[model samples]
Target: DTAALMKTPLKKGDTWYLVDSRWFKQWKKYVGFDSWDKYQMGDQNVYPGPVDNSGLLKGGDSQSLKEHLIDELDYILVPTEGWNKLVSWYGLLENQEPIARKVPNAIEKEMRKLFSIPDEKEIRLWNKYMSNTFEPLNKPDSTIQDAGLYQGQVLVIEQKNEDGTWPRGPSTNKLTLTLQ
Candidate 1:
């Protein structure tokens, strides 16, 4: 079904995940339809089911507080500062798709320009950090090593830690330096 959908030309009823207003506008232009109308149709919800969550669980009247404590824990543990922190760290969260596609490349380009390195020093640094940090956490028997330099100014090093263990301390860890 997915393959068929992809192969067939998009029709009026076909669903799409628009990245932003710009992409929506572009799709509207291509499809010869009013963007507002398309948005209106997309906004409409026609689910044929009870909307409320109340009284949905079995034995709802007799449910004990101790038994359901974990279920309500998420509500109590809500990080009020999380949204602000995420926005501060990652910028506006609404336009995530475009930012996800564009930001790393932009950052890499800027870093390369700032460092004035012909080779991809930034990518190497990223690879090193991932090897040291994530590979240990996720996989076994994976070792990263220095892959050599891209440009004269940059050095490409592979992770050599066999156990995939991350080094500790402030100045000694390659991952820490790369992140900084």
Candidate 2:
């Protein structure tokens, strides 16, 4: 019955970007409808029930997360100072999309080079662990070897807010690091 309203028949590889309710109002004007009532009566099919998460999906159903992932750099972690300078250079905001590149095998060495950190000093990667805490990534790190990193991971250097409060360090500070 829904197919009867579509201008074109749904194809085998059809996909759609679902927008939230906040942006849904813009569709009426963009679709050239004079009023909400007219839009409601248009060729597009409407479901009366609430949207279900499992109902609409973009990619192949059989593919695993690893299969869906590309072998490219997914995230970058930079020190706050260095990040500020880099943002100034690009004239952009704090968050930006990454340009695609192959994931490096030697993440420790690569991160040191990117961070301009010394060999003796260990560079720690941090991520949000809970509501207000962040924890350092625990991986094999050394001057001579890789940090055993993989793609799709986002890590950052710890930072303190402007109110003289630490955002994500207390939890990690309490954790004891033991060497085997």
Candidate 3:
């Protein structure tokens, strides 16, 4: 039913069902309906967006996040300061959607190989459990999915600021790596 209704206008109560506002905005402009705000119904709450951890979703988000993430960058590799410290840069992959059902402690051993980390510093990614040997990935794991990383995305190999922020050495700095 919803699939068949995609091309047609839909309403939830008195408000218009907004599948996507950006698409609608662009759709209107491409069709020369941008100024047709009067034709556009419903409040901002009808916008569509990604679902958060609670299994709940916030609708009608335009600037904060996006949907149909196939053509976007899933994550950014940001270098930390001092030694090697990687904070979280979360963006989901393009073609390969993440397995959202998985628990928070998702594991990805290969993510370690993606980083250009020094040999001595690699252990920093693991917890200090020398004897028991029950250590897990110290790398930023949430950026990784058990299903595998997004295509063409790789790790950052730079030093971040002492406060655990990405280093912006110049007016513009972009570090991209190809996942091996």
Candidate 4:
């Protein structure tokens, strides 16, 4: 009869517990979660990659018009150092002849619309997925489609590295872009 007197009524999804000083830490466990500010700190890269129409993948706050150009133009040639590696690594390798095959030079208008090439620097695109080999569409009459580039593929813009060396090799760039 004494034991029955101590029994308490319970409800569904409710727990009955006898907590003490030791339970203080246990109670805090329920609140263990990340806030938006904490989640905001994420990996950032030096260069940008190809972006979607809205530029969500590139991070809306940091999305650059250069990145959007790749998505906008019909056939814009990108330089090796121009595109973001962390962004467009996988898309380029999915198609055959992933190499900068031979897009026609007529895309010059579109390419020019993207950016003006300096006398020293030529607009180029590369596959940094596993390699740093950059191919330049020197001829404006050429289209990158001939360079084995398909829709949604990415090519890095070729440029001088900090050390004044061209990005190269699987060691430096990471993988060889073997074209079929």
Candidate number with greatest lDDT: 2
Stretches of candidate 2 off by over 4 Å are 1-103, 129-131, 140-152, 158-180
lDDT of 4 by residue, 108-164 (tens): 445555666554664444443334344444444445543445444555555556566
Position 115, candidate 4: lDDT: 66
Task: Tell me the lDDT of model 1 at 142.
Answer: 21
> What TM-score, computed on C-alpha atoms, does each candidate reach?
0.18, 0.27, 0.18, 0.25
As a whole number from 0 to 100, the lDDT of residue 81 in candidate 4 is: 28
- In candidate 2 the C-alpha lDDT for residue 12 amounts to 23
lDDT, candidate 1, 37-60, per-residue tens: 454333324211211112222344
- Return the TM-score for candidate 4, rounded to 2 decimals: 0.25
**Would you list the C-alpha lDDT of every candidate in the order shown?**
0.29, 0.36, 0.30, 0.34
Which whole-number lDDT from 0 to 100 does residue 33 have in model 4?
18
Candidate 2 lands at a TM-score of 0.27
Writing each residue's lDDT as its tens digit, candidate 3 over 53-113 gives 1111224432333333331133211112200110122222133222222122322333345
What's the lDDT for candidate 2?
0.36
